[model samples]
Target: MVGALAVLAVVLILWQILPGALNVPRYVIPPLSEVLVALTDPVAFPRYVQNAAATMTEVGLGLLIGVVLGLALAITLTQLPRVYGIVFPYIVAIESIPKVAIAPLFVIWFGFGLPSKVVVVVLLAFFPVLVNTIHGLRNVDRDLINLFRVNGASRMQIQVRLMIPAAMPQIFSGLELAVANAMIGAIVAEFVGAQQGLGVLILQAQGRMETPAVFALLIILSALGIFLNLFVRLARKWIITWERT
Candidate 1:
């Protein structure tokens, strides 16, 4: 932690001094001090809160819905190989399309609303969770599965008691990736069309040439991503306590 803080301190120092030392225009890259000031600017702070709230809502909704859908689909695929063979290719094809490229289409379909942003986030998050969960479920120990069968465990009992627990680690990894993707999806969708969000704030700052504000917003986003990643880590520890063994 100390080393990380030291590195961050050095970066901040450089950010504060480099533009002046190298004669870079403030409009191009404002000093870190200026960006900090923008972060605390009383007039803009409320707006920041409002926009951030919108983005957070989209992220939360999308993450919950995406994870649930992914888990359901993974379980279905695992239990029904024929269905998996039929639909997995279609899923891959949809996931193959660039999410950014589809943002505008989502806006057209969902109409510049929060629903569009949430849908984009769902798309971004769904595949990772599905793939990871499926991988974990499919790779369970055959010996253990046979043992369960020999002991007269029902298929549902084996799945609930063994498979899902075993899959938690991979599922958590997917959740971490999904968190980042969800953030990106929300921002990208907002950029395409939204009345409010950090993305909209960024577009506004860019339009007004408020470079410091833009940098500040980016910093806010990075911090949010970090918080979410940490949250997932904590949740993983709680849910997968046996992992420590």
Candidate 2:
């Protein structure tokens, strides 16, 4: 932690000084101090908070729905291999489309509102979990499965007591990827169309050529992404304790 802090300090120092030293244009890349001042502006700070909250709401709702749907579909496919074989190709084809390219379509369908942003996030977040869960469920130990069968364990019982638990690592891996994708989706959707969000705020700042404000908003986004990824890691540690042992 101390080492990380030191590295951050060095980066901040460089950010504060390098522009002036290199005779770089402030409009192109503002100094760190300017960005900090922008963030701490009394009038703008409140607006930033409100917009960030709106974006977070979209991310949280979309993530919950996506994860639940991914898990359900994965479980269903695992239990019915024939269905998986039939639909897997179609699923892959859908996943192949660029999510950013579809953000405009979502806005057209759902309007320039919260629903569009949430739909984009769900599209970006679900596939990783579905793929990882399917891989984990199908790759379980044959011996362990037979042992459960010999003990007369019902299919549902084995799924709950064995398959899901065994799949936790893979699920968590997917979740980490999903969190980052969720952030991207929210921003992209907001970029395409939204009443309020960090992405919208960034666009406004860019339009006015508020270089410091744009840099400040980008910093906030980077910090948010790191915090979310860290949260996922902590949750993985807590839930997958057996993996560590």
Candidate 3:
């Protein structure tokens, strides 16, 4: 962890110095010090941080919905072969549509607000969860399934006791990747519509040539994304260890 922080510190220190050394305009790309100021300054921070909060809210809600729906769908696919056959093509179709193209329609249906952003995040987040979860569950041992049957476990019992536990490691790994994608979807959704958020703030900043603010907003989003992934990873590690012998 110290090594990683050292690398990040070196990168940021270079970022702080490099642009000014190159004599670049703040309009095109601001120096890291200026961007840091925009991020740390009270007035700009509150205004800019709202977008990050908005996107975070959307991501949280969207991730909840995505995990539930993905797990349910994975359960169906792993156990109900007929339903899986029927639904696989549609899942692919839904995932194939470009999110940017779909964002406007989401706005039209759900309005230019949090709901629309959640929809986009869920769409972007679900595929990873579904694919990984289905893969994990299907890869379960046939001997284990027979063991559950010999013990007279019901279908639900077998699924709840066996499949979910066995699949957790893969599911957690997929979820970490999904969290990053969800953040991206939330940000992109905000960019397409809505009055407040980092997306709108970024648009306004770009219009006014406030490149420092844009970079600051991006930094905040990246920080939030890292926080989420790291938290989940630590939680997953503990859970995996606890479940093992």
**TM-score (all chains, Cα) for each model:** 0.97, 0.97, 0.92
lDDT of 2 at 188: 89
lDDT scores for all predictions? Answer: 0.93, 0.93, 0.85
Error of 1 at 212 (Å): 0.3
Candidate 3 accuracy as TM-score: 0.92
Model with the higher TM-score, candidate 1 or 3: 1
Compare candidates 2 and 3 on lDDT and give the better one. Answer: 2
Q: lDDT, candidate 2, residue 23?
A: 94
Clashing pairs in 3: 51-197, 51-198
lDDT of 2 by residue, 32-140 (tens): 9999999999999999999999999999999999999999999999999899999999888987888678999989999999999999898889988898899899988
Which residues of candidate 1, in runs, are more than 4 Å off? none
State the weakest 10-residue window (summed lDDT) of model 2: 91-100
Native-structure RMSD, model 2: 1.2
- In the order shown, the candidates' Cα RMSDs to the true structure are 1.2, 1.2, 2.1
lDDT of 2 at 183: 97
In model 1, which residue pairs have backbone atoms overlapping below 3 Å?
none
